[model samples]
Target chain A: MDMTFEIIGWLAGICTAVSFVPQSLKTFRTKNVAGLSALTYTVYNLGVLGWVVYGAYLKSYQMVVFNAVCFAFSFSVLAMILRYRRRSRL
Target chain B: MDMTFEIIGWLAGICTAVSFVPQSLKTFRTKNVAGLSALTYTVYNLGVLGWVVYGAYLKSYQMVVFNAVCFAFSFSVLAMILRYRRRSRL
Candidate 1:
């Protein structure tokens, strides 16, 4: 049971770590922030950065690695949103 | 220093918990999934659920609380994506 829970945690970590891929890929290709929220990604990236730092403080490699990957993907998406944001629709 | 990291982790958790709100609200209002990724939210929801269960096993209320809030917001977004996704845009 303990091992099962551990596996669940590990899998959960991986799921979140990689989940940003799809959004980043689609945004990268489409360059669309029409439906994306700048505030969401902005806060999310800062959270991930905090997590990375917290993980480092905790000496937890799993936390650091997972959040680092999320940061990379989410930050990329956020940057794209800024780059391609619709300034004015006429 | 330790307390600072703890505070960081707490803040990080709160940021993640609330970060989904803007996206969900925007998607709810605009009914746009053009910039949203179904797979990302789908996986993220699953991951958050897993974290809730993992927290239960670990007897960690913080994990459960934060992730449960995230699940609520993110699931709403995912539902919006499925509901509002355009089909056969011609």
Candidate 2:
């Protein structure tokens, strides 16, 4: 049971971590900001950052690592939105 | 110290939970998924579902609840993507 839960947790962490990959790629490739929400990514990145801090406090290495990974993906997405949105304006 | 961490956790949870709202709303209102990635939302939903299950095992109310909220938002976004993409094709 312990091992089972461990697998489940890791799977959950991996899923959460990798979930941003497709969006990041699509957004970067297409450079479309039409449907993406800047507010969502901004707040999401902040939350992910907070999770990294909280995880460190709790010493939950998985959370720290995965959320950090997630943060990178999301932060890049946010940056893309800002960049693309700016370019679109100009 | 404990209270501080607790507050941090809840704030993190709130951020994660509400982060999806803007995207969902924007997607629904604009009906523009061009910038969105179906694979990302699909995998993200699955990951969040996993979190709900893992949280249940740990009896973490916040995890279960926040993740459930996140799931709903992401799921709707996924559904909207399918719906709109189909409509777009037709």
Candidate 3:
């Protein structure tokens, strides 16, 4: 059971990380922010911050590591959106 | 610190759960899974399953509760995708 939990933890962490791939790819490929929502990503980054703090408090390396990666991914996505949004307005 | 962690945990859980909203809305409105990848979602579901087990092992209520909600949301989205894919094919 213990080993099972560890395996599950690893799978969960990896999946959660990998789940961002599609959007990342789309953003990278299209360089378009037309479909993605600014508000959503803003809240997402905030959420990531909260998660990182929470994970640190709990002393959970999995939570900290994964949320930090998510933060970086989301930040990049947000930057892309802002850049495209600005470019479109120009 | 404990209180702070609890607050952060709540925020993280809510954010993670809320993150699914845009995709759900898009899927609901467009009835289009063309942009969404089935493989991504399949892996997401598996990840959610793993998180549930890991959370249980860690005795973390936040993980179990939030992931369960996310699981339901993702399941609905997946079902919608399947239905739409079938409809589109015909």
Candidate 4:
């Protein structure tokens, strides 16, 4: 693979990995999650987990790092949604 | 790459790509997007577009196909958020 292509892949990975930050921050700030879906987050986390496994299988450092970071952020958001939803129900 | 690894990659890609369907369906059914973030979607679209470019550079058909599907679904959700926000503001 060309070095340039590798750089592009890294760039893409970074972008995708960090894409959840703004939303997570918003959710943290607002503590509002009426628009968020638990089912979506659950499935998304599973997908990210699959990517993590695939990354390990392929020995792709970029894939592993990117998806790992994404999984953490996504998991946090999912946790927040669960917390908020439970609180709201009470 | 091992064929098994390729299969895992495709599985991961499919999971990630189709992950948005449930959320999009929920939004469509409920017509509720109070929790969706326009900024997040915008950045996400950019990220997915970056992935598309990176996929093209790598000649990875799976990457290209997966991100293309993701981009379409993310865009529709963004559009819905915009529309709903505008209507709600009035």
Who wins the TM-score comparison? 2
Judging by lDDT, tell me the better candidate of 2 and 3.
2
CA deviation > 4 Å runs, candidate 1:
A86-90, B86-90
Q: What is residue B35's positional error in candidate 2, in angstroms?
A: 1.0
TM-score of chain A of each: 0.94, 0.95, 0.86, 0.90
Give lDDT tens digits, candidate 1, residues B1-90. Answer: 899999999999999989999999998898878878999999989988999999999999999999999999999999888876755253
Candidate 1, A1-90: lDDT as tens digits = 899999999999999999999999999887778999999999999998999999999899999999999899999999888888754353
Q: Give the Å shift of residue B49 in candidate 4.
A: 1.5
Superposing all C-alpha atoms, what RMSD in Å does each candidate have to the true structure? 1.9, 1.0, 2.8, 2.4
- Which of candidates 1 and 4 is the stronger one according to TM-score? 1
Per residue, candidate 3 scores C-alpha lDDT tens digits across B1-90 of 688789878987888767667767767886756544465567777888788888889998878888887787777777777889999899
Q: How large is the interface RMSD of candidate 1?
A: 0.7
- Ranking, DockQ, top scorer first: 1, 2, 4, 3
lDDT of 1 at A12: 93
Model 4 error, position A21 (Å): 0.7
TM-scores, all candidates, are 0.95, 0.97, 0.79, 0.88
Give the poorly placed runs of model 2, Cα more than 4 Å off. none
Of the pair 1 and 4, which is ahead by DockQ? 1
Candidate 2 similarity to native, TM-score: 0.97
